[model samples]
Target: MTTSRTYEDLVKEAVDASVDGWDFSWFEGRATEERPPWGYARSMAERLAVASAALDVQTGGGEVLASAPSLPPLTAATEGWPPNVAKATALLHPRGAVVVASPEDASLPFAEGAFDLVTSRHPVRTYWPEIARVLRPGGTYFSQQVGPASAVEVVEYFLGPQPPEVRDARDPERARARAEEAGLEVTGLQEARLRMEFHDIGAVVHFLRKVIWMVPDFTVDRYEPQLRSLHARIESEGPFVAYSTRFLIEARKPGR
Candidate 1:
C-alpha cells in the first residue's frame, strides 16, 4: 500500500494524524513494532486486584491503568501534561482512580509511605528517592522503562552517531543501584530488544512527532532533506528497520 503512495501525500497524512492518546493504534498498517514478552498491563492488573492502595506515575491518557480488570480501593495516578491530565482523569475517574497533575521528575504530591504499590510505563525519568519516599515500607514499584539505546537507528539517522553517555542513559544497572541507594531492594529485572519496521516515511513522521523526545525539536520543515532522503531509501530498499529496547523492573521497600 505504501509503495503506491507519494512522499508528499504520505507525509501530509501523517502530519495531520491526531496523536490524541497513548495507544499505538494509529500505526496499524503503516508501521509495526514487536511487543515485549511481558504483558505489563495484565501483570500490573493482577497486582492491583490484591493491593489496598496503588498509584500510577506518568499515566499518559490513563490507557494502561484503565484496562485493568480490577483496581485497588484507593487508586490514584499522576500526569504532568495538562492535556494528558485531563484525558487521564476522564478515563480513570469512572474506574475510581483519581488523577493528579505532577511532574515526572518532581517529588510526588502524596504523603510519605502512602501507597502500597506504584507503577509507571515508559516514564521519561524515574526519581528513585521520590518513589521510595511515597511507598509504604513493604510497597513495590513496578515499571516498564525504555532501556538504553532504544530506537537508536532513528536517532542516529537524524542526528548522526551519539556519544556513549547518550546511548547508555537509561542503563538498567544504574536504575538498580539508584533504587538500592534509596533503600529499596531490587526484585526483578528483565529486558528485551524489539524489532521496529516503518513501511513508509509517514509512519516515521508520525512516530517522531508523537515521541518528541526522540528528536527533541523535530520539525518537518527543518528536516525535509533528511526526510526526503529517507523516503527515497524506503522506496528503493523496503521498510526501514530499527530496534527498541525496553526493560521491566520491580523494586520493593524493606522492613515489612
Candidate 2:
C-alpha cells in the first residue's frame, strides 16, 4: 500500500521548517498581504538619514535597517532571540551597526540619551519608559506595530471566538496613553486593516510558526483537527481570507 500525501504531511513540513530572523519571503506565492498606504520602510529610511544616532529595538535579522539607503554614524539594534541576534549581527555588522542580544522585557542596556532616534518594526512589546530613557531630549520613537485584533480570523480559526478584551488588547489608544505616561509627546499615528490570504495549509502553518503570537501554543499535533478543517475549506473555497491590522506611531521626547 502506498501512502498519499496528506494535509498533515504539509503541515508537518511547515512546522519543521526554520522560523528564525523574521523573514517572510517563504510565503511569496503561498500567501499575500496588502501593504499600508504609508510605506513604513520609506518613512524609516527618511528618518534614518537625518538622525545622528539611532537604535532599533527588536531588530529581527536587521533586514529592514540594512535596506536603508544610509545609516547614521552610530547605529545599534537589539534582538531578544539568539538566532535573530546572530543573523542581525551578520547582516548589520557590515553596515557599521551593532547588534545586541537582549531579552524582550529587560531594560535596554544602553545609557540614558544614547540615541537621537529609536525605531522598531512589529516589536513584541514596546518599553515606553526605556525608549524615553535611551532617547536624547527631542529624540523620536517611530514604529510600525501590530494593532488590536490583528489576524484575528486566523487566530479564531484555531482557538474559536476571542473575548472583546482579548481582541482589544493592543489598541492604539492604549498605546498612546502609555506613551504619554512615559513622557513622550505623540506626534503621528496611523492605522490600517490590510487584506491577507493563505493559499495553502502549508502557508498557514508556516505563518503560525513564524508569528508564534498569532496562535499561541500552536503545534501541528495540537491543532491537527482545525488545520485539517482549514485545509479542506481552502481546497473548496479557494483561499483563507484574513485581515491584519497595523499602526504607525511616532512619539518625540521634549526639548531640542
Candidate 3:
C-alpha cells in the first residue's frame, strides 16, 4: 500500500526541494483562493434560478457550489477528479451532487440538454465539446483557465530537459471556437496577466513543490541530479534571474 506523508512532512519536503529560502507569500496566502471574476458563479446561479437544472463542470473542491447561494440543485460531474469531488462534496452540501470519475473522455453524467447552464474552472481542452453537448440550447457555458504560458516552459528551463506532454487547456480563442461549434454563443471573454515574483531560485523550487499544478504524471525524479547540478552552477555564477507569467483566459456562454 502507498503511504502518505503528514501535512508537515509534505510541506517540509516541498521546501527542501527548492533549497533556496524564497518569499512565497503570494502563493501561500492564496493557496485556497478561488479563481477570480466570479461572474461565472453569478451567471450560473442566475441561469439555474430560471432553468430547472445546472451543472458544475469538473467541480474542484466544490468551492463554486458552496459559495453560490440557493443554486438550483447543483449536480457535479468530474471526468477524472474523483478524490477532489469526494472531498468537495463533503464541504458543499448541495441538494444532490453526484460523482462520476471516468478515465475515458466522456460527457458529464447528465444527458444531452441536461442542464441549462454549465461551468468549469481550468478545464482541460478535451472536455470542451462534452461541456457543450450536455448543456441545453441557450444555456450558458462559463469557464476560467490557465493559459499555455502558465509556468511550464520556464519551469522546464530551470529543471533541465522536458518530460512527456503535460495536459493543458486550449488557448482562449480555440476554446471559444469549440464552444461556438458546440452551438453555444460566446458572450463574455477576459484575460488577466499577473507577474508573480519569486525571491530566488529556491523560492521557485519551493513554489514548484508546494503549488506545482503541473500534470500528475509530471516528475522531477529523473532530473533531480541535473537540477542540483544547475543549482550549483547558478550559485557559482551569481544571482539567478527571476521572472513571471502572461495573461490567462476566461470566457462565458451567453443565455438565449
Candidate topping lDDT: 1
Give lDDT tens digits, candidate 1, residues 1-256. 2388899999999999977659789899889999999999989999999999999999999999999999999999999988889899999999888999998778899999999999999998999999999999999999999999999999999999999999999999999999999999999999999999999999999999999999998999989999999999999888999999999999999978
Please give, for residues 146-242, the per-residue lDDT of candidate 2 as tens digits: 9999999999988899999989988999999999999999999999999999988999999998998888899888988888888888887777999
Q: Is candidate 1 or candidate 2 better by lDDT?
A: 1
Higher-ranked by TM-score: 1 or 2: 1
lDDT of 2: 0.93
Residue-by-residue lDDT tens digits, candidate 3, 1-256: 1123333343345555532211234445222222344455576566556656667655656665556666665565564555564666666554566655654366466678777767665554446667667777666666666654565544665544454434234366766677677656677667654445332344335556544454333345544564555455444574334332222333344445
Q: After superposing candidate 1 on the true structure, give the runs of residues whose Cα lies further than 4 Å from its correct spot.
A: none
Better of 2 and 3 by lDDT: 2
Model 2 residue 56 distance off true place after TM-score fit, in angstroms:
0.2
TM-score of each: 0.98, 0.96, 0.65
- Which consecutive 10 residues in model 2 have the weakest lDDT in total? 1-10
Give the residue spans of candidate 2 off by over 4 A.
Answer: 1-9
Alpha-carbon local distance difference test for all models:
0.94, 0.93, 0.53
